[model samples]
Structures are given as C-alpha cells and as structure tokens.
Target: MVEQSTRATDRPLPLPRANLLHLLEQMVLIRRFEEKTMEMLALNRIRGYCHWNIGEEASVVGAVTALTENDRLITSYRDHGFAIARGTPPETVMAELFGKEGGCAGGRGGSMHMVDIARGYFGGYGIVAGHLPLAAGLALAADYLGEDRAVLCAFGDGATNIGAFHESLNLSKLWHLPVVWLITNNQYGMGTSVHRASAEAELYKRACAYEMYSEQVDGMDVLSVYEATERLLRRAREDREPSLLETLTYRYPGHSYADAGKSYRTKEEIERWHQRDPIRLFQRYLEEHGILNQGEYDLVERRVSQKIEEAVKFAEESPFPSPDTLFKYLYAEEGTK
Candidate 1:
C-alpha cells in the first residue's frame, strides 16, 4: 500500500444523489442491525461465535452494490452486513444468527455460514483460509460451466498470510478464472497491524506476482470503493480476467464483541477512524447535494431502527431447528438409500 496522501490534506470523497442515499441507507441498516446483534449477544439470546462487520460498512455497501446480481460472493465469518447488503433478507440473517428454523441454512448455519446460494452468496466461511480455495473452485466451476458470471471472494488481511490464499490465487490465474479477490485489509490482522506480522505489508503486490491486475482503495470512501469495484467487476465480466482489490479500511468495534479493546488498539486510534465514518460521510454528501434533508436522512435512520427491531422480533418469535433437521442438509440423502 503506497501512500497517496502525504503532508497535504486530501479532498473528501463525494457521492452522487441516488447512489449516495442508497449507500447511506445500507450503512445505517448495517449499523442498526449489528448494534442489535451486539445487544442480543450481551443478553445471551444469540449463541455461538459472532463477529460483526461494523466500521467496515463502506466496503460491504460499496462492493456488494457494484456487483451484478448473478456475480457470486464468498466472505469470511464477520458477514452479517455482507449478507444483508447482498440482498439476503435481514429477517433471514437475523434468524440465522439466532439459530431459528427459518434462517438461511434452515437454522443450522449460524454466524459463520449464512449462505444464500440463490443470491449467489457462496458462504460466510468460518475457517480463515478455507474459503479462498472454495471461491477459486467456484470461479473455475463458472468457467467450466461456461457462464459469464464471476466470483467475488472477500477475505481479510489475515488470510493473505495463509498458504491457501497463495495457492488459490495461483490456480485462479493459471486457469484464467473469472473472479475478483476483494481483500478487506482493515489494518489489523486479528490484533496485530499488517506491518507487525507481514514483512512486506503491501499485500496487493502479491497479486502482481501472479500478474493479476490490482489496486488499493480507501475503504472508508464508499464512492471510491464503488468506482473501483465497478471497474474491476466490469473487466472481470467482460474479459474473464481475474483481479485483486485491497480495501484499506478499519473496524470500529473490537475484533469481536468479547474483545475489550485490548492492548493492540488505543482509544485515540478508534476515535480517529470514527471521525471519517462511512455513514456520516455519505449522509453529509446526501445533505450537500440537496437530495435529502435532515428530516429525510432521519427517516432513513429511523427506518433502519424499525427494520432491525422487526428483524429481531421475527427472530425472537421464530422456533429453533429440530434435532431431526440436524442431519438433513448435511450430506447427500435418500435417492440411493
């Protein structure tokens, strides 16, 4: 990651009208929904491992919006917002997180695997580097199936260090798979900075080694993310070439709800990132463009609050999956039996 900004201040990124509002709404929804999840987790209403993609709202909103409906998406465990933005109903995601029967994976797949294949979401993979290869397989499958659709594999900076990431990218290039690797490098690889763990913190350069076209973008800027993703997605779809995008973003909350702002991160660092929050940035753009007034913007926020309330309500009122269903979707069944 080269520094595009130095001693001089850089211009604040801008967004257009409709897209600006849409991005704002999505970020609000994600914020409200995740806040609800954290509340639920604190109350012990939702069990199992839960990771929230809070501060990385811009990356989720912008990248998913720029993708085609048919383009496949595969992301890591911190995927509540990712799934929702990919058009998976909040109710399903909430229910899935709550482990209810109506959840995306029939209540079985919890936070780490709420995949709606119908929407082309491959999964919320739990294993760190496990899904990278799976996504490469998906891209190769698309090529073999002769479909124009491309696979969008979203992973974190941590996975970049894993060997599967390297092997997967090698294969993706070798086969000319139509795919785009969207690496959300949120500064911290777990609790350590990229520089702390990686000798060469420029992770995008890994793409260049494979001759894969790559670019680094300010993940806090939704417009910049959208533009870059739009271009990358267009090229992947049009040329069947694979690309890699490194989103230099930050996570507002600690690594997980259980984390207590450990020694690795400081209050000032978190506060600094909060200043350029994606939600506020987009809302400001909407107001400046005169597309939405304060009242209208308040409506979006209120709607998100209500929507998240209903989603939690729906999950609360729903039933958990029966023990019999445990073995149902797990493996192949009865035609041979």
Candidate 2:
C-alpha cells in the first residue's frame, strides 16, 4: 500500500511573505527561461540535447527553497530549472546552454550537464541512474567528514528501474547516509508513461524493499513539495535517515527538444495536466490568499522577462571557449604545493 503525503490545503503557508514572493519569482524565471530556451533552439542559438522544465516549476522551486545553502543538490538531465532555483545566475545558465565561455560549466557541459560546486549543486547527469551512486558517494563524504549537510538526488521515474537506484537506496539506509531520493515522476519517461513502463507505478513504494521512509506528493503543488522535502531534509540532517519522495508531475513538452510532444499522449490528457499547471496553480493559491495581487504578478513577469533578455544577450555576445582549453578539465591533477 502507498502512503499519501500532506495536501497543500491541510496547512497554512509556512513561509514569510517575501519568501513566498521569491518562490513565485523563481517559478516565473524558470518558466520564461525555458520558453526562451525553446526559442533559442529554434534559432540555432542553443545546440545539443536540450530538455525544458515547462510544467514542473513547482517541483524545482519548492524543493530547492526547502534546502539551505550548505545542502547539496543533484539531478537528472532536465536541469535548467533546478540550476536556476539553486541560485545559479540565469545568465550563466543560459550561457552554458549556449555553450559559451560564461556558462556555469564554462561551456563544456551543455544542456544536460550543469555544475556549480561552490553553490553545492553537483550537476545534472546525462545517463539514466548514473548519478545515484555519485549522490551516495557525496553523502558518504559528508558522513565521513561529520558535516551537517544533506544531499537531495532528483531523478525521473525511468531511473527507478535501474539497479543503481536500489543499490544507492540500500546503502544509504544501511549506513544511514543523509540523502533524499526524489523521483520527479513526470508520468512519462521520454516516450513511455510510468503505467506503461513499471509494474509498480507508485514509485515511493519501492522504498519499502529497502525499509526506508517514503512518501508521494502532488508535484504540481508547490506547498506540498516544499513541506514534504523540508520534512525529509530535516530527517536526513537530524536523524541521518534516508528517504524516497515521489513527486507526481508531468512534462508539458516532449521528453526532449527533438520530439513533438503530442504523438505519444492524448490531447485531453495534456489539457488535463495543463489545467493544473504548477505555476498557475501556485499563482491562484497566492491570489486566493491575497498574497499575490495583479500588480505583483505583473512585476514578477516584467523582471523575469528582463532577466531572460539579458541572459540571451549575454549568451549571444559571449565567445565560444578557445580550442586551447579543450583538454583542460577532463581530470584533476595534483598540485605541486
């Protein structure tokens, strides 16, 4: 049997007014950044495999908000939203997508790979389930160093089927590593739906095998995501417990840029998800509570638009990395000092 997590309505807003507004701003920024990214791809400004976080804004913003600066984050290929939510400058993120020198990864790690270690964002890994072990390794490092940090490893439903997911979770629980396994279950993994792909579609229940704590949340609801992630983070930090959180989300677009998102899914199904769009849902919640009025919404839109424009301009003018630096970052070398 699957356990239901807290509903967005069961509790009052836990954050301050400014923080609530900031959440809205971050969601808006991610939405606009992705829209612009699609446009840039159309214009050939951004190349390579690009994934857009169009409908999953709440999942990114809410969870990232629940984290402290010291907490670490790692995620799968659909990562621009996470990077922005983790406070990576939109300009640098866009530059990274543009494969320019100013990007977060200095232009090498394009669309699928974004890393900002100083901010504790490990990066988005390209291979499915490949980063689970890395997340465990990071958590082990924290355990060894006796640091008070937790690691949030975000991946899609597809990864749950991989062997590494089980290995990571098993070790995490056995060793009591401070790691939260977040499954951003966007219904479909690439062209396949969870129902079609996995025998146990309710992913959080998979944690039962490992005897780890787990819960499923409304991924489209920002408050629910924040509350659950915050709870799990606290458990990881205070008790050295590991958990699996499954966010029931949907990706508005196709899995990646190349496919037209409509063929595999039905029009009615798409419309249904759109009606509960994470951004609009949160906006309504704010409006209903008198927290975000029309003026505030407009201001956020204007600001986000300006930021996206600046990012695009910066990416456009930035130079591609010179050929000489091609072999620089492949591996770390010992310092003579």
lDDT scores in order: 0.84, 0.91
Per-residue C-alpha lDDT of model 2 across residues 1-337, encoded as one tens digit per residue = 2125555555687888898889889999999999999999999999998888888898889888888888999999999999999999999999999999999999999999998999999999999999999999999999999999999999999999989999999999999999999998889989988988899998999999999999988998888889899999989988999999988888898989888888899999999999889888888888988899899899999999999999999998889999999998877768732
Per-prediction backbone clash count: 0, 0
Q: Model 1 Cα displacement at 95 (Å)?
A: 0.6
Candidate 1 lDDT, 1-337, residue by residue in tens: 3236221113343455566788889988998899899899988888987788888998888898888988999999989999999989999999998889978877888988988889999889888878999988998888898887888889899889889999988988888888889999888877889989887798888898798999888788777788788888888878888899998888887787767655798888889888878778767766665677989988998898888888989898889988876678667777743
Clashes of 2: 0
Candidate 2: where are CA atoms >4 Å away? 1-7, 333-337
Q: Which ten residues in a row have the lowest lDDT in candidate 1?
A: 1-10
**Cα deviation of 329 in candidate 2 (Å)?**
1.4
| lDDT value, residue 241 of candidate 1 | 86
Q: Where does candidate 2 have its weakest 10-residue lDDT segment? A: 1-10
Q: What TM-score quantifies how close candidate 1 is to the native fold?
A: 0.94
**CA lDDT, candidate 1, residue 294:** 88
